[model samples]
Target chain A: MQLKNIFQEGAIAAHFIAESIAKHATKTEIGGHNIFLGQVRADDIDGKKVTAIEYTSHVDMALEKMHEIREAIFAKYPLTCMHVHHSLGVIKAGEICLFVFTSSKHRKAAIDACAECVERIKAELPIWGKEIFEGDGYQWKVNN
Target chain B: MSIEIIFFGQLADKTGCSNVVVDNPGSIDALSMVMKMQYPNLATAKFVIAVNNKIVFDNEPIEENAKLAFMPPFSGG
Candidate 1:
Protein backbone atom coordinates (compact mmCIF):
# COMPACT_ATOMS: atom_id res chain seq x y z
CA MET A 1 0.00 0.00 0.00
CA GLN A 2 1.36 3.43 -0.90
CA LEU A 3 1.15 6.09 1.79
CA LYS A 4 0.21 9.53 0.57
CA ASN A 5 1.74 12.78 1.89
CA ILE A 6 -1.56 13.42 3.80
CA PHE A 7 -1.29 17.21 3.84
CA GLN A 8 -3.57 19.21 1.57
CA GLU A 9 -3.33 22.98 1.03
CA GLY A 10 -6.95 23.67 2.03
CA ALA A 11 -10.02 21.74 3.10
CA ILE A 12 -10.66 18.17 2.07
CA ALA A 13 -13.55 18.25 -0.35
CA ALA A 14 -16.48 15.84 -0.48
CA HIS A 15 -15.54 14.65 -3.98
CA PHE A 16 -12.11 13.68 -2.79
CA ILE A 17 -13.65 11.67 0.01
CA ALA A 18 -16.04 10.00 -2.41
CA GLU A 19 -13.25 9.04 -4.77
CA SER A 20 -11.30 7.53 -1.91
CA ILE A 21 -14.20 5.31 -0.98
CA ALA A 22 -14.83 4.43 -4.60
CA LYS A 23 -11.27 3.16 -5.00
CA HIS A 24 -11.86 0.44 -2.41
CA ALA A 25 -14.96 -1.13 -3.96
CA THR A 26 -12.87 -3.61 -5.97
CA LYS A 27 -11.44 -5.15 -2.84
CA THR A 28 -13.93 -7.95 -2.19
CA GLU A 29 -12.29 -9.12 1.03
CA ILE A 30 -13.03 -5.89 2.90
CA GLY A 31 -16.16 -6.20 5.00
CA GLY A 32 -16.23 -2.86 6.77
CA HIS A 33 -14.96 0.69 6.45
CA ASN A 34 -14.84 3.40 9.06
CA ILE A 35 -14.23 7.09 8.57
CA PHE A 36 -13.50 10.02 10.83
CA LEU A 37 -13.78 13.63 9.78
CA GLY A 38 -12.62 16.64 11.77
CA GLN A 39 -14.35 19.88 10.94
CA VAL A 40 -13.34 23.41 11.88
CA ARG A 41 -15.74 24.77 14.44
CA ALA A 42 -16.83 28.36 14.82
CA ASP A 43 -15.89 28.72 18.42
CA ASP A 44 -16.73 31.84 20.36
CA ILE A 45 -13.84 33.27 22.31
CA ASP A 46 -13.80 36.50 24.32
CA GLY A 47 -17.12 37.47 22.70
CA LYS A 48 -15.59 36.99 19.25
CA LYS A 49 -16.39 34.13 16.93
CA VAL A 50 -13.81 32.18 15.00
CA THR A 51 -13.96 32.69 11.25
CA ALA A 52 -11.37 30.17 10.15
CA ILE A 53 -8.43 28.07 11.19
CA GLU A 54 -4.96 28.50 9.68
CA TYR A 55 -2.90 25.38 10.00
CA THR A 56 0.87 24.97 9.79
CA SER A 57 3.30 22.22 10.55
CA HIS A 58 6.87 21.10 10.85
CA VAL A 59 6.23 19.30 7.57
CA ASP A 60 9.13 16.87 7.41
CA MET A 61 8.77 15.75 11.01
CA ALA A 62 5.01 15.48 10.83
CA LEU A 63 5.17 13.24 7.79
CA GLU A 64 7.77 11.07 9.44
CA LYS A 65 5.71 10.74 12.61
CA MET A 66 2.56 9.97 10.62
CA HIS A 67 4.37 7.23 8.78
CA GLU A 68 5.34 5.72 12.11
CA ILE A 69 1.79 5.92 13.35
CA ARG A 70 0.49 4.20 10.22
CA GLU A 71 3.01 1.40 10.53
CA ALA A 72 2.13 0.81 14.16
CA ILE A 73 -1.57 0.75 13.45
CA PHE A 74 -1.15 -1.72 10.61
CA ALA A 75 0.93 -4.02 12.77
CA LYS A 76 -1.52 -4.00 15.64
CA TYR A 77 -4.70 -4.38 13.64
CA PRO A 78 -5.93 -6.68 10.90
CA LEU A 79 -6.66 -4.00 8.38
CA THR A 80 -6.85 -4.00 4.63
CA CYS A 81 -6.15 -0.29 4.12
CA MET A 82 -5.95 3.10 5.81
CA HIS A 83 -5.71 6.71 4.71
CA VAL A 84 -5.20 10.00 6.51
CA HIS A 85 -5.41 13.59 5.24
CA HIS A 86 -5.18 16.99 6.90
CA SER A 87 -5.54 20.54 5.67
CA LEU A 88 -2.57 22.89 5.84
CA GLY A 89 -3.89 26.33 4.95
CA VAL A 90 -6.82 28.42 6.11
CA ILE A 91 -9.97 26.34 6.47
CA LYS A 92 -13.18 28.17 7.15
CA ALA A 93 -15.60 27.17 9.85
CA GLY A 94 -17.77 24.15 8.99
CA GLU A 95 -15.21 22.80 6.54
CA ILE A 96 -13.45 19.52 7.00
CA CYS A 97 -9.82 19.72 8.10
CA LEU A 98 -8.90 16.14 8.84
CA PHE A 99 -9.98 12.78 7.46
CA VAL A 100 -9.10 9.22 8.44
CA PHE A 101 -10.27 6.18 6.56
CA THR A 102 -9.74 2.59 7.62
CA SER A 103 -10.96 -0.65 6.09
CA SER A 104 -10.77 -4.17 7.41
CA LYS A 105 -12.12 -7.63 6.79
CA HIS A 106 -14.27 -7.29 9.89
CA ARG A 107 -16.25 -4.52 11.49
CA LYS A 108 -14.47 -4.44 14.82
CA ALA A 109 -10.99 -4.01 13.41
CA ALA A 110 -12.08 -1.23 11.09
CA ILE A 111 -13.94 0.66 13.81
CA ASP A 112 -11.21 0.27 16.40
CA ALA A 113 -8.38 1.12 14.01
CA CYS A 114 -10.13 4.22 12.73
CA ALA A 115 -10.68 5.60 16.21
CA GLU A 116 -7.17 4.79 17.31
CA CYS A 117 -5.73 6.40 14.20
CA VAL A 118 -7.56 9.66 14.94
CA GLU A 119 -6.38 9.73 18.55
CA ARG A 120 -2.78 8.94 17.65
CA ILE A 121 -2.71 11.50 14.89
CA LYS A 122 -3.91 14.21 17.23
CA ALA A 123 -1.38 13.39 19.93
CA GLU A 124 1.63 12.52 17.83
CA LEU A 125 1.56 14.87 14.84
CA PRO A 126 3.56 18.12 14.81
CA ILE A 127 0.78 20.30 13.41
CA TRP A 128 -0.37 23.66 14.75
CA GLY A 129 -3.52 25.67 14.26
CA LYS A 130 -4.33 29.34 14.74
CA GLU A 131 -7.93 30.36 15.33
CA ILE A 132 -8.60 33.42 13.23
CA PHE A 133 -11.35 35.46 14.80
CA GLU A 134 -13.84 37.47 12.79
CA GLY A 135 -12.12 40.79 13.42
CA ASP A 136 -8.64 39.59 12.39
CA GLY A 137 -7.50 38.73 15.93
CA TYR A 138 -6.15 35.23 16.44
CA GLN A 139 -5.24 32.73 19.13
CA TRP A 140 -3.28 29.53 19.06
CA LYS A 141 -5.37 26.39 19.42
CA VAL A 142 -4.53 24.01 22.20
CA ASN A 143 -5.68 20.42 21.96
CA ASN A 144 -7.14 19.03 25.16
CA MET B 1 30.14 25.11 17.41
CA SER B 2 27.10 26.42 15.63
CA ILE B 3 23.64 24.84 15.50
CA GLU B 4 20.60 25.57 13.41
CA ILE B 5 17.40 26.37 15.32
CA ILE B 6 13.95 26.26 13.76
CA PHE B 7 10.78 27.38 15.48
CA PHE B 8 7.28 26.21 14.66
CA GLY B 9 3.71 27.31 15.39
CA GLN B 10 3.25 30.03 17.98
CA LEU B 11 6.86 29.83 19.07
CA ALA B 12 7.89 30.98 15.61
CA ASP B 13 5.64 34.02 15.94
CA LYS B 14 7.03 34.89 19.34
CA THR B 15 10.59 34.59 18.10
CA GLY B 16 9.67 36.83 15.12
CA CYS B 17 11.65 34.57 12.75
CA SER B 18 11.29 30.88 11.88
CA ASN B 19 14.97 29.96 11.83
CA VAL B 20 18.26 31.14 13.30
CA VAL B 21 21.80 29.94 13.81
CA VAL B 22 23.37 30.06 17.24
CA ASP B 23 27.03 29.73 18.15
CA ASN B 24 26.31 27.96 21.42
CA PRO B 25 26.30 24.20 21.01
CA GLY B 26 25.52 22.25 24.15
CA SER B 27 22.54 20.48 25.62
CA ILE B 28 19.02 21.47 24.65
CA ASP B 29 18.85 23.26 27.99
CA ALA B 30 21.67 25.57 27.02
CA LEU B 31 20.01 26.46 23.75
CA SER B 32 16.82 27.25 25.60
CA MET B 33 18.77 29.53 27.89
CA VAL B 34 20.22 31.47 25.00
CA MET B 35 16.86 31.65 23.26
CA LYS B 36 15.18 32.94 26.37
CA MET B 37 17.76 35.70 26.66
CA GLN B 38 17.61 36.66 23.01
CA TYR B 39 13.86 36.37 22.63
CA PRO B 40 12.43 37.34 25.98
CA ASN B 41 8.91 36.39 24.97
CA LEU B 42 10.00 32.76 24.61
CA ALA B 43 10.90 32.62 28.28
CA THR B 44 7.23 32.34 29.17
CA ALA B 45 6.20 30.31 26.15
CA LYS B 46 5.59 26.59 26.32
CA PHE B 47 7.39 24.37 23.80
CA VAL B 48 9.37 21.22 23.17
CA ILE B 49 12.76 20.73 21.57
CA ALA B 50 13.54 18.35 18.70
CA VAL B 51 16.99 17.48 17.43
CA ASN B 52 17.18 16.45 13.79
CA ASN B 53 13.38 16.01 13.61
CA LYS B 54 13.12 13.89 16.75
CA ILE B 55 11.74 15.35 19.94
CA VAL B 56 14.20 15.48 22.80
CA PHE B 57 14.15 16.66 26.35
CA ASP B 58 15.99 19.71 27.65
CA ASN B 59 18.86 17.65 28.98
CA GLU B 60 19.57 16.05 25.61
CA PRO B 61 22.97 17.06 24.30
CA ILE B 62 22.90 18.90 20.97
CA GLU B 63 25.69 18.10 18.55
CA GLU B 64 27.46 20.72 16.46
CA ASN B 65 25.60 21.66 13.26
CA ALA B 66 22.53 19.85 14.59
CA LYS B 67 19.15 20.89 13.34
CA LEU B 68 17.00 21.78 16.35
CA ALA B 69 13.30 22.53 16.18
CA PHE B 70 11.30 24.32 18.85
CA MET B 71 7.67 23.23 18.74
CA PRO B 72 4.65 24.28 20.70
CA PRO B 73 1.98 21.83 21.81
CA PHE B 74 0.29 20.16 18.82
CA SER B 75 -3.32 21.10 18.14
CA GLY B 76 -3.97 19.08 15.01
CA GLY B 77 -6.97 16.80 14.69
Candidate 2:
Protein backbone atom coordinates (compact mmCIF):
# COMPACT_ATOMS: atom_id res chain seq x y z
CA MET A 1 0.00 0.00 0.00
CA GLN A 2 1.35 3.42 -1.08
CA LEU A 3 -0.34 6.65 0.00
CA LYS A 4 0.94 10.06 1.15
CA ASN A 5 -0.45 13.18 2.78
CA ILE A 6 -0.87 15.19 5.98
CA PHE A 7 -4.30 14.12 7.06
CA GLN A 8 -6.73 15.15 9.80
CA GLU A 9 -5.13 13.02 12.50
CA GLY A 10 -1.49 12.52 13.30
CA ALA A 11 -2.17 9.56 15.59
CA ILE A 12 -4.28 7.79 12.99
CA ALA A 13 -1.59 8.13 10.32
CA ALA A 14 1.11 6.80 12.65
CA HIS A 15 -0.94 3.66 13.16
CA PHE A 16 -2.18 3.32 9.59
CA ILE A 17 1.11 3.52 7.70
CA ALA A 18 2.83 1.41 10.35
CA GLU A 19 0.16 -1.22 9.94
CA SER A 20 0.63 -1.21 6.19
CA ILE A 21 4.34 -1.84 6.55
CA ALA A 22 3.81 -4.55 9.15
CA LYS A 23 1.42 -6.43 6.93
CA HIS A 24 4.01 -6.70 4.20
CA ALA A 25 6.48 -8.22 6.63
CA THR A 26 4.25 -11.04 7.89
CA LYS A 27 5.88 -13.58 5.60
CA THR A 28 9.39 -12.52 6.46
CA GLU A 29 11.51 -13.08 9.54
CA ILE A 30 11.96 -9.34 9.84
CA GLY A 31 12.16 -8.01 13.34
CA GLY A 32 12.30 -4.26 13.83
CA HIS A 33 10.49 -1.32 12.23
CA ASN A 34 11.16 2.38 11.87
CA ILE A 35 8.73 5.19 11.25
CA PHE A 36 8.82 9.00 11.11
CA LEU A 37 5.57 10.89 11.54
CA GLY A 38 5.71 14.59 10.79
CA GLN A 39 3.33 16.80 12.70
CA VAL A 40 2.20 20.36 12.11
CA ARG A 41 3.18 22.43 15.10
CA ALA A 42 1.41 25.56 16.26
CA ASP A 43 3.24 28.56 14.86
CA ASP A 44 2.53 32.05 16.16
CA ILE A 45 3.23 34.83 13.68
CA ASP A 46 2.68 38.37 14.89
CA GLY A 47 0.08 36.99 17.27
CA LYS A 48 -1.57 35.11 14.37
CA LYS A 49 -2.06 31.47 15.06
CA VAL A 50 -1.61 28.76 12.46
CA THR A 51 -4.76 26.71 12.67
CA ALA A 52 -4.07 24.43 9.76
CA ILE A 53 -1.80 23.64 6.84
CA GLU A 54 -2.77 23.38 3.16
CA TYR A 55 -0.39 21.35 1.02
CA THR A 56 -0.07 20.90 -2.75
CA SER A 57 2.30 19.38 -5.29
CA HIS A 58 2.85 18.50 -8.91
CA VAL A 59 1.07 15.15 -8.74
CA ASP A 60 2.82 13.47 -11.62
CA MET A 61 6.24 14.72 -10.60
CA ALA A 62 5.69 13.74 -6.99
CA LEU A 63 4.66 10.20 -7.80
CA GLU A 64 7.66 9.83 -10.02
CA LYS A 65 9.92 11.06 -7.25
CA MET A 66 8.35 8.55 -4.87
CA HIS A 67 8.98 5.76 -7.32
CA GLU A 68 12.61 6.73 -7.63
CA ILE A 69 12.88 7.01 -3.85
CA ARG A 70 11.45 3.54 -3.39
CA GLU A 71 14.09 2.17 -5.71
CA ALA A 72 16.83 4.16 -4.00
CA ILE A 73 15.86 3.00 -0.53
CA PHE A 74 15.77 -0.61 -1.62
CA ALA A 75 19.26 -0.31 -2.96
CA LYS A 76 20.45 1.46 0.18
CA TYR A 77 18.73 -0.53 2.91
CA PRO A 78 18.10 -4.10 3.87
CA LEU A 79 14.37 -3.92 4.30
CA THR A 80 11.38 -6.15 3.86
CA CYS A 81 9.10 -3.25 3.02
CA MET A 82 8.76 0.55 3.03
CA HIS A 83 6.06 3.17 2.56
CA VAL A 84 5.80 6.97 2.36
CA HIS A 85 2.74 9.22 2.52
CA HIS A 86 2.20 12.97 2.78
CA SER A 87 -1.02 14.88 3.25
CA LEU A 88 -2.50 17.36 0.86
CA GLY A 89 -5.10 20.04 1.68
CA VAL A 90 -5.86 21.48 5.10
CA ILE A 91 -4.42 19.86 8.21
CA LYS A 92 -4.87 21.28 11.66
CA ALA A 93 -2.17 21.89 14.22
CA GLY A 94 -0.85 18.77 15.95
CA GLU A 95 -2.02 16.81 12.90
CA ILE A 96 -0.16 14.31 10.80
CA CYS A 97 2.06 16.10 8.28
CA LEU A 98 4.07 13.26 6.76
CA PHE A 99 4.57 9.51 7.31
CA VAL A 100 7.50 7.22 6.50
CA PHE A 101 7.61 3.53 7.37
CA THR A 102 10.34 0.96 6.98
CA SER A 103 10.81 -2.59 8.15
CA SER A 104 13.89 -4.80 8.06
CA LYS A 105 15.42 -7.91 9.60
CA HIS A 106 16.80 -5.79 12.42
CA ARG A 107 15.99 -2.54 14.16
CA LYS A 108 19.22 -0.66 13.49
CA ALA A 109 19.16 -0.88 9.75
CA ALA A 110 15.47 -0.19 9.57
CA ILE A 111 15.79 2.92 11.66
CA ASP A 112 18.75 4.19 9.69
CA ALA A 113 17.08 3.62 6.35
CA CYS A 114 13.87 5.29 7.47
CA ALA A 115 15.78 8.37 8.52
CA GLU A 116 17.66 8.46 5.25
CA CYS A 117 14.50 8.08 3.22
CA VAL A 118 12.72 10.85 5.06
CA GLU A 119 15.69 13.18 4.81
CA ARG A 120 16.04 12.53 1.09
CA ILE A 121 12.40 13.29 0.43
CA LYS A 122 12.44 16.50 2.39
CA ALA A 123 15.55 17.66 0.59
CA GLU A 124 14.56 16.61 -2.92
CA LEU A 125 10.83 16.18 -3.47
CA PRO A 126 8.62 18.73 -5.23
CA ILE A 127 5.88 19.38 -2.68
CA TRP A 128 4.64 22.63 -1.11
CA GLY A 129 2.43 23.69 1.79
CA LYS A 130 0.93 26.85 3.27
CA GLU A 131 0.04 27.44 6.89
CA ILE A 132 -3.50 28.79 7.35
CA PHE A 133 -3.68 31.25 10.17
CA GLU A 134 -6.64 32.01 12.45
CA GLY A 135 -7.71 35.12 10.56
CA ASP A 136 -7.95 34.30 6.87
CA GLY A 137 -4.20 34.56 6.38
CA TYR A 138 -1.61 32.06 5.15
CA GLN A 139 2.08 31.61 4.42
CA TRP A 140 4.03 29.11 2.34
CA LYS A 141 6.50 26.82 4.08
CA VAL A 142 9.09 25.67 1.56
CA ASN A 143 12.51 24.15 2.33
CA ASN A 144 12.24 26.22 5.46
CA MET B 1 11.68 23.09 -29.06
CA SER B 2 9.08 25.32 -27.40
CA ILE B 3 8.39 23.14 -24.38
CA GLU B 4 5.64 24.32 -22.07
CA ILE B 5 6.74 25.70 -18.71
CA ILE B 6 4.20 25.24 -15.97
CA PHE B 7 4.67 26.42 -12.40
CA PHE B 8 2.88 24.73 -9.59
CA GLY B 9 2.19 25.58 -5.96
CA GLN B 10 3.80 28.77 -4.63
CA LEU B 11 5.61 29.58 -7.85
CA ALA B 12 2.37 29.70 -9.80
CA ASP B 13 0.87 32.02 -7.26
CA LYS B 14 3.80 34.40 -7.69
CA THR B 15 3.92 34.14 -11.51
CA GLY B 16 0.14 34.65 -11.88
CA CYS B 17 -0.27 31.85 -14.43
CA SER B 18 -0.38 28.09 -14.32
CA ASN B 19 1.60 27.48 -17.51
CA VAL B 20 3.45 28.97 -20.50
CA VAL B 21 5.36 27.77 -23.58
CA VAL B 22 8.99 28.79 -23.57
CA ASP B 23 10.76 29.68 -26.77
CA ASN B 24 12.70 26.72 -28.10
CA PRO B 25 16.43 26.81 -27.46
CA GLY B 26 18.75 26.03 -30.35
CA SER B 27 20.42 23.36 -28.16
CA ILE B 28 20.39 24.11 -24.45
CA ASP B 29 19.00 22.92 -21.16
CA ALA B 30 15.42 23.60 -20.09
CA LEU B 31 16.78 25.50 -17.10
CA SER B 32 18.31 28.17 -19.34
CA MET B 33 15.06 28.75 -21.20
CA VAL B 34 13.20 28.77 -17.90
CA MET B 35 15.57 31.49 -16.67
CA LYS B 36 14.96 33.49 -19.81
CA MET B 37 11.19 33.27 -19.68
CA GLN B 38 8.71 34.41 -17.07
CA TYR B 39 10.00 35.28 -13.61
CA PRO B 40 13.52 35.92 -14.71
CA ASN B 41 13.66 37.75 -11.46
CA LEU B 42 13.49 34.39 -9.72
CA ALA B 43 16.79 33.39 -11.28
CA THR B 44 17.99 31.86 -8.06
CA ALA B 45 14.91 30.02 -6.92
CA LYS B 46 16.53 26.75 -6.02
CA PHE B 47 14.15 24.22 -7.46
CA VAL B 48 13.84 21.36 -9.93
CA ILE B 49 12.29 21.27 -13.37
CA ALA B 50 10.51 18.15 -14.60
CA VAL B 51 9.63 17.21 -18.15
CA ASN B 52 6.47 15.13 -17.85
CA ASN B 53 7.54 13.97 -14.37
CA LYS B 54 11.17 13.35 -15.26
CA ILE B 55 13.80 15.75 -13.88
CA VAL B 56 15.55 17.89 -16.47
CA PHE B 57 18.79 19.69 -15.61
CA ASP B 58 21.01 19.55 -18.64
CA ASN B 59 20.19 20.61 -22.21
CA GLU B 60 19.50 16.88 -22.77
CA PRO B 61 17.37 17.35 -25.91
CA ILE B 62 13.78 16.95 -24.73
CA GLU B 63 10.68 16.62 -26.89
CA GLU B 64 9.54 19.84 -28.56
CA ASN B 65 6.05 19.51 -27.13
CA ALA B 66 6.98 18.16 -23.72
CA LYS B 67 4.90 19.41 -20.82
CA LEU B 68 7.52 20.82 -18.45
CA ALA B 69 6.63 21.64 -14.88
CA PHE B 70 8.77 23.54 -12.35
CA MET B 71 8.41 22.99 -8.65
CA PRO B 72 9.85 24.77 -5.63
CA PRO B 73 11.09 23.05 -2.47
CA PHE B 74 8.78 20.27 -1.37
CA SER B 75 7.15 20.73 2.05
CA GLY B 76 4.94 17.63 1.94
CA GLY B 77 5.01 14.95 4.53
Q: How do the residues A1-144 of candidate 2 rate in per-residue lDDT, one tens digit apiece?
A: 473432332233556765676577555777888888888888899899989888777776677777778788899888888777777777789978788878889998889999988888787777777888997878888565
CA lDDT, candidate 1, residue B76: 96
| Best prediction by TM-score | 1
Worst 10 residues of 1 chain A by lDDT: A1-10
Summarize candidate 1's per-residue lDDT along A1-144 as a digit string, tens digits.
Answer: 354598999999999999999999899999999999999999999899999999999888888889999989999999999999999999999999999999999999999999999999899899999999997789999998
Superposed on the true chain A, the predicted chain A of model 1 yields a TM-score of 0.96
Model 2 misplacement above 4 A: A1-25, B22-46, B60-62
Task: Give the CA lDDT, 0 to 100, for residue A66 in model 1.
Answer: 92
Evaluate chain B of model 2: give its TM-score. 0.71
Whole-model lDDT per candidate: 0.92, 0.73
Q: How many clashes in each candidate?
A: 0, 11
For candidate 2, give fnat to 2 decimals.
0.80
Where is model 2 chain B poorest over a 10-residue stretch in terms of lDDT?
A: B26-35
Evaluated with DockQ, which candidate comes out highest? 1
Give residue B4's lDDT in candidate 2 (0 to 100). Answer: 72
